[model samples]
Target: WQLFTKPLPQPQSKSQNRQGGEQIVLLGLAAMAGALILAIYASGATALYNYSYKAGLMLLSLITLALLYWSLERLVRSPWGRILKAIREDEQVAKALGKNVFWYKLQALMLGGAIAGIAGAFYAWNLTTVYPSNFEPIITFNSWTIVVLGGAGNNAGTILGAIIFWAYNSITRFVLPTEIIKDASLGAFRIMSIGLILMVLMIWRPQGILGKKEELTLGQ
Candidate 1:
């Protein structure tokens, strides 16, 4: 969703071509870090299902998401925010104006990750069990669908997108054919429909219903 399509650091960045070697290195490091972290936590697996498990996990996720977004908002001190906006408009010009472009991008990445983390936590909560297959790329793809349907760069639009998408999702649960199709099959098709809706909107009304075109454009 917001993490995938909206751009790397917003999907429309100029130097986005990460070479093969670079990708491999990045992924390798990520895998190694993941393994190390898992090893460190291997001894604490039993507590994952204790009485306080749900509460603790939920609270941790909530706090993490809140703090992450809060830090980003703080960075948006009117002047700095404007600078970031201008950078979003044209990075070269922002740098010419003496703004720290790299730092701003880094901050944006952190903020974006925090935002995605919030979405992920909500997703995790809604699921009764955790498994590898559940977190397929499609989940993110569906989120992008929601984001695009509501409008890019518009948090309100993202919320609306979530609402509409979920509505469609729930409706299909009881409305789609049952004799010829199971609930899981309907849900899959519904997600695909959401993706299709996103593509259609991008072609017909990219700005979304309540969003400004310029503000909701690919970059800005």
Candidate 2:
């Protein structure tokens, strides 16, 4: 597998190359899922088994957030991280130079999935249950809004985006007159406000408040 990532002494057939790539992707996904499950179970057991559910979840969220931030920061600064950025910019060029483009992409997918899985677990824990409605398409759009508002490539920006998004909702819910706007109308107003904010951001600062102009891949 390691040898496949380096320049091959001789070119392999297309079938063989395809098979290898598929195997790598499958293996990477399995490993990522397994690790995520194991970590969640271990943390849940350690926290929930010994303490109240709310307390356990709180502890777990703090620990998870810290570790996630630290790990991602380190990973993004590593040599392999540079390769990831290069691949993102031009996968064909990376592949042409004997870099395992499939492997890199698979790694990125697995990493992203694992992080999202952890977040989902925490959210479910908070809600005390998971429902089909929780996985709605609008959730994906909201995530995109957070990412775009914070900054696409900046981790700190992402965190800031989430904070700002939620803070706005929290403030509005507290300040808005429930007598004038019923629950449904209040929800609709929040969504409308978010849409308006996003539109203004897109027009005035498409790169995001914290995102650098160079980090943007939109016009490029």
Candidate 3:
């Protein structure tokens, strides 16, 4: 992990996750579902919006996408973000400083839920019509790798990480397992290969390609 300068999962805070309760998860799932529904609905609405007002549906889609970005910004920059940061540093100190820690945590979670919902809306509109089948577990894990490649705490790093991750994935998928090596379902092999890469990255260089050692600390 030190070799890469990325932050591996450390014994962070139980409250970090405790703050995100079942409600948030349920709402998030529901939002994804709703996005699927809306996408199907858009199959009809698209023509209507275009016929009735020309580009109206597409415009709405653009607005929805804008809202998604806005929501992410809000989640990252709002008061809740501060609270989460505070809690991350020292919950006891934050409470001693007279912060309504629980409320801030709750708001952080609900904001996450809403942001996911907005993302679903965009996915439904822009991507292949949203469906549960479309959301695979690999999507989540892939995101993790991207986060590592970029810089754990840096948005710019995350973007770069995404690019690097996809490129690496494509290259490995093509290069590994030549005709002689034989194919045994990329599903399992790729999983192991990626996991190995992550494990090696974690052990050797956890700070990420561009992140600083100070920025990648597990805790005090």
Cα lDDT of model 2 by residue, 1-220, tens digit: 7643654333343323222221222222222233333344445556747545455665566677667767777877897776766655555556787787767656776777667776777666655678998778766666777767876566766766766776686667777788878887787888898999999999999878788777555113
Q: What lDDT is obtained when candidate 3 is compared to the true structure?
A: 0.54
Those runs of model 1 whose alpha carbons end farther than 4 Å from true positions after fitting are 1-77, 179-188, 216-220
Error of 2 at 4 (Å): 9.3
lDDT (tens digit, per residue) of candidate 3 on 1-220: 3433332233366445323322243234334333433443445556755544333445565465445445544655766555566665566666678775566656657765775666565565455456788878876666566666555444445546655555565555677657634566665777787788888877777867765566444243
Q: Rate the local accuracy (lDDT) of all candidates.
A: 0.51, 0.62, 0.54
* Top candidate by lDDT: 2
Q: In TM-score terms, which candidate is top?
A: 2
Which of the two candidates, 1 or 2, achieves a greater TM-score against the reference? 2
Candidate 1 vs 3: which has more lDDT: 3
| Model 1 residue 206 lDDT score | 84
What TM-score does structure 2 among the candidates reach?
0.73
